[model samples]
Every structure is written in structure tokens, then in C-alpha cells.
Target: MTVDCAVIQRETPAPERPHRRTEGPVRTCVGCRKRELAVDLLRVVAVSNGNGHCALTVDQAGNLPGRGAWLHPDDRCLQAAFRRRAFGRALRITGSPDTSAVVEYVRAQTGAD
Candidate 1:
């Protein structure tokens, strides 16, 4: 019954908006191609030693710049990614993944097995 013009400004066409794009960061999962919020995916980095028992490690802070791989917090997804060499192929290098530690980390962080 009442239109508050002061509260609802008229939607008159304003000058063309500048070509500013609001982009959000994204990272792809090793097991899945779908891009996810950058922080949503776990970062996997190739360790320094090319040959070592644990040559792969997770980047909890996402600070390392060397090529990174992603894995969901889900256990099955992580298992599939590791089983399929998705991380290695994505990063093109690999030695070892402290899977137990990673699982523990994921569990503590995501609380999802």
C-alpha cells in the first residue's frame, strides 16, 4: 500500500559499470576436476629429495609455490587420488606421501575420514 522511494532508490540505468571482474581463487582436486575454493583443497607439494621414503608432503598453509596438487578432505577421495597417482601426475613429480600424517591432519582439520 506504500512505496518508500527514499528507502528504495529508483533502478534507473546508471553509467556503464567499469569492466571489473570479481574473481575468487580456486584449486582443482587431484581426484576431481571440479575447481574448489582455494582453501577448500589440501595442498600437496613434492619434497626436496627426489628419492626418499616421504618425498611428498601436504602444504597446510598453501605457502609453497612449487606446483601444487589438491585433494578433498574425504577419505575415499584422497585414497582414490593417491591410488591413481593423481598428485604425482598433476605435479609431474613424487616420492612419498606421509598418508598417515595427512589423514591425521585432515581428520583434525576437517574431522572427516
Candidate 2:
């Protein structure tokens, strides 16, 4: 007499890995002190033309070389940053960097005067 046997098959589950952040780089807004993606905020850098003058220029293309400070394009944020002197602290500047250009740029981009 011959006995019949049955075999059972089982499937194994794969292990899960931690998800990586693929939404680009993250940076903090100097004005509001909020953490946001780098691409969403504007990049500004202190520029010196070697003429005993320095100014803060908005790096719309985000390709300027030097210490960069990030901020939102909102007037409120701008005011807050200015009030708190975040630009100087962030950029390690002794005197206040000319922010008119940056304000104008932000205004133009955000349509806020």
C-alpha cells in the first residue's frame, strides 16, 4: 500500500525600507523661522564689488556664490526678518546689507508692494 502526502507552499514577505525624501532640499526661512523646501524660498547673497560697498542681492537663479540667506517673498516675513535682523545674523554681516533690491525683487515676484 502506498501513502499519499501533500505539500504546502507559503510565500514570504519582503522587508520594508525607510522612505527617502525625494522632494528636494529643505531650508529654513530666516524671516518667519519656518522650515520649508529650498526651492520654494528665495535665495539671497551678500555681494561685494571690491569698491568698499556691499549689498544683498536676490539670487533668483539660486547660483550665487557666498553665504546665502533664505526668506519668503511675503512682506510680513520681510518685515519680521528685518525687525529681527535675521539677514545680518544669517549672512554674518556686520552692517545691514542693502535690502531695497531684495524687497523690490520679492514685491515683483509676489505682486506685493
Candidate 3:
């Protein structure tokens, strides 16, 4: 008499494991267009500079109201974003918003002039 092992295995249930949370929120860099952890990228937002003009500001703490864009803290990424105008589009602003603040922040962070 031969017992069917396949039948016995099919009747057994597999153990379930709990889902594990390992990483924080992931964001895409508007400059390099690469996915990265939110903690690794700088958050940027557009705000009025009191002259009815919108300007880009770096959210160092990553907690600011309004649409936010992510970017790598590198000079290459900064230049790429400027060349492609990714900042204005990502922040949903009309015309070229002032980027002096953002540029300075990146320079300071990267130690670049």
C-alpha cells in the first residue's frame, strides 16, 4: 500500500509572518529623478517673498506646509534641476521662482561655491 505524500502536503497550511516596517517614507529627487529615502534628500517649497513673488525655500527639517519637492544635496543635482526647471514644475509655481535660497542651502550643505 503506497500513501500519497502529495495529498498530505497539500492539506498542510504554511505559517504566516508579521509584516515588518524597516524604512521611512521614500521620495524621488526632482533633480536627478532618482528614488531615495526622505531623510537623505532635502525638501523644498515655494513661498511668497512679500513682494508677490514666489521663491523656493529649503525645508531643512522637512516639515513645512505646501507642496514640497525633494532633491539631493549635491551640486550636480542642483544644476540639473535648474537646467530642467524641475523646481518650478515640481512646486507648481508659475514663471521662474527665486532659487537663491535653495542654491545657497545646497552650496552650504555641499561646501560648494
Candidate 4:
């Protein structure tokens, strides 16, 4: 029996699919530790609260200066971050940062009491 080596050699190769490009910067949510587009996550920065204490402030425009930690706008994510004490570690701050503003913003956005 003759082997059809020519037929196998003549077969066309399958086309390769193009890789999808991410449009913007990607960030990981401190709460869930899930990677997501920066636009989809909320940016927060640590600022002095006038009492020599650092507090977490939401940077809606994402233009705030200094180190920022990312989190999803969901309440669950906020709670998880709080439960894990991730903000302090992620923001590289000593002691716990006030989360009232972040919590309030998330609550308002999620309409959660």
C-alpha cells in the first residue's frame, strides 16, 4: 500500500484567531482580588483626616495623587475588604484607615442600607 504523504503535506493550516487587546489599565480588586479594568473599579487613596490619622477617600475621577487601592463598587466587596483588612495593607498605611467615605459611597451607589 502506498502512503499518501503528498496529501498530508498539501493540507492547509488552520487560521489563528486574533488576540483581544485590553483597552485601558487593569487593576485588581483588593476585596475579591479579581483583576478587572481600571475603569470598572473604584480608586481610593489614603489621606490625613486632620487628626493625624489616615483615611480612605474615594477618587471618582481617578486623578488623586498618592498610592491608591482598587475595589469594586459593590457592598460585598467593601465588606470583604474590611473583613480582610486589605485597605491598610494594600495602601501601605499603619493602623486602620477610616472607611466611612468608601462605605458611604458604595452604599449610595448600591442603594444598600
lDDT of 3 by residue, 1-113 (tens): 99767744455566888854449998999989998889889999999888878989999877789999999999999999999999888988888998999888999988853
Candidate 1 residue runs with Cα over 4 Å from true position: 1-23, 50-54, 94-98, 110-113
Task: Give candidate 2's TM-score.
Answer: 0.76
> Which structure among the candidates has the greatest lDDT?
4
Clashing pairs in 3: none
True-structure RMSD, every candidate: 9.4, 5.9, 5.0, 4.1
**TM-score head-to-head 2 vs 3, winner:** 3
In model 3, the runs with Cα more than 4 Å from the true position are 1-22
How big is the positional error of residue 30 in model 3, measured in Å on the Cα after superposition? Answer: 0.4
Q: Residue 110: error of model 1 in Å?
A: 4.3
Model 1 Cα lDDT, one tens digit per residue, 18-83: 863336687778876667876777887776644454456678888987888888877777777868
Which residue pairs in model 4 clash with each other? none
lDDT of each structure?
Answer: 0.71, 0.87, 0.89, 0.91
List the candidate 2 regions with Cα displacement exceeding 4 Å: 1-22
lDDT string for model 4 (58-79, tens) is 9998899999999999988999
TM-score per model over all chains? 0.62, 0.76, 0.77, 0.81
Positional deviation of residue 69's Cα in model 1 after best superposition, in angstroms? 0.3
TM-score of model 4 vs. true structure: 0.81
Which residue pairs in model 1 clash with each other? Answer: none
At residue 71, what lDDT does model 1 achieve? Answer: 82
lDDT of 3: 0.89
